[model samples]
Target: MTSIPNVTLNNGIEMPQLGFGVFQVPDDETTAAVATALEAGYRSIDTAAIYGNERGVGRAIAESGIARDELFVTTKLWNEDQGHDATLAAFDASLDKLGLDYVDLYLIHWPAPARDRYLDTWRAFEKILGEGRVRAIGVSNFQVAHLERLMENTGVTPAVNQVELHPGLQQEELRAFHERHGIATEAWSPLAQGAVLGDQAVADLAARYGVSPAQVVLRWHLQIGNIVIPKSVTPERVRQNLDVFGFELTDEDLRSLAALDRGLRTGPDPDTFN
Candidate 1:
């Protein structure tokens, strides 16, 4: 079993540092893929309403017969679903599809600065939190400006901020900001969406630890205190991702990995995506 420790959220929830992500996972194949992940001992499943696979993921969990309390399920509100009432309706729809009364984490999918309604959306999230329908609430792809505005306006801080973090795009400044605000940083594309898998540095680290490149990347995220949710369809790779508990990365190895951070990104910049 992986020896990674669970990181406590601002709300006192202990979530596994490494989770299973289903970003591009299709609806038809979502169930089997999630079932495989559950069998592989993944306690956390990260999905989104935009992914259009919530039902499949829910079915997998229901069929697994694993008690709801034993799992941590996270989903996000799409860009089109912003504001107080719209967000509540969206949350209910997502919950209905997932077959859960409450979610472990619910995030604003994007800042959508142009829409200028995340503050309102967050207010709705707080409402849900107060009702105890959701264990934790958060944001995703949020820049510093967005976070600051939210803090200034709502006077509520999110439990986590899921971002596009990988060895290539370190986002050190944002991570520091999250640390200052007591918000955990969760990495969405932890593998750079497969862009850094073949890098010589990652390859060398994998060779040193007798693990796959993915394992080395996931381990690096763990060392940096960032929760990582790596996505995969193949059973072998999914299993390989979770078996990163034994070895420890040396200081020298970590320094080398830091040098690999080129600030490159495979996803659209949230600041201008809208």
Candidate 2:
């Protein structure tokens, strides 16, 4: 098994820079997917309450017989559960469903800025950490404005901000802001939902490196110092995604992909939605 590198969080927790994500993966399919990822040597698992597959993830980990400490399990608090107390209540529910004593990471699923609840939601995360029920806390789909609001209101910066980052939607400004703070940037939809997998630039780079385009994409994220959790139900792709550690991208190659940024965001804009 190839070892994926780790990045230390501001809080002094060590996190794997790459992991497996289970978004839109149904409950029935999650077990096999997670099991395959585990068998493929992935140590981290990212899931969510909204994903409705936490039970399957917990079952896979329990059956895999890997020590809980050896595995990094992460889940999130949904929009409806966004206040301090409600978020805490939601954590109990997620834990009940996940069948675990604790989670390695817990995040506020979205800022829900319109609802104005993330401030309290982050407080709940702080509580979770104080209780040692969660090792680290973060946010997802949060932009710079949302992060600034969170920091100003709560005085706690997230350990990671998982967002939609592909070549098309580089989110360079937001990433720079994350770097300015102690927060680590994590890439969701790291393949741009396969949007860039067929691009000529990625294809040429893949050919040059003797790797798949997906590996090139993952490599780009790692080279930029972003944590990535690429999702795949296929076992071969599951194994292939983690096989990105052997190769590296050059500065020129990195600049070329950076040029492909069209400011195209595939997911809904959190600001407009809320």
Candidate 2 CA-lDDT value = 0.91
Off by over 4 Å in 1: 1-4
Compute the lDDT of residue 146 as modeled in candidate 1: 92
* Consecutive 10-residue window with the lowest summed lDDT within model 2: 265-274
* Top lDDT hit: 1
lDDT of 1 by residue, 1-274 (tens): 4454789998898888989999898988999999999999998999999999999999999999999998999999998999999999999999999999899999999999889889999999999999999999999999999999999999569999999999999999999999999999999999998888899989999998899998999999999899999999999998989998888898899998899899888888999876
State the lDDT of candidate 2 residue by residue for 173-223, as single tens digits: 998898889899998999989998898999999999999999999999999
After superposing candidate 2, which stretches have Cα over 4 Å from the reference? none
Candidate 1 collision pairs = 3-245
Query: After aligning candidate 2 to the native by TM-score, how far in Å is the CA of 35 from where it should be?
Result: 0.5
> Where does candidate 1 have its weakest 10-residue lDDT segment?
1-10
In order of appearance, the predictions have TM-scores of: 0.98, 0.98
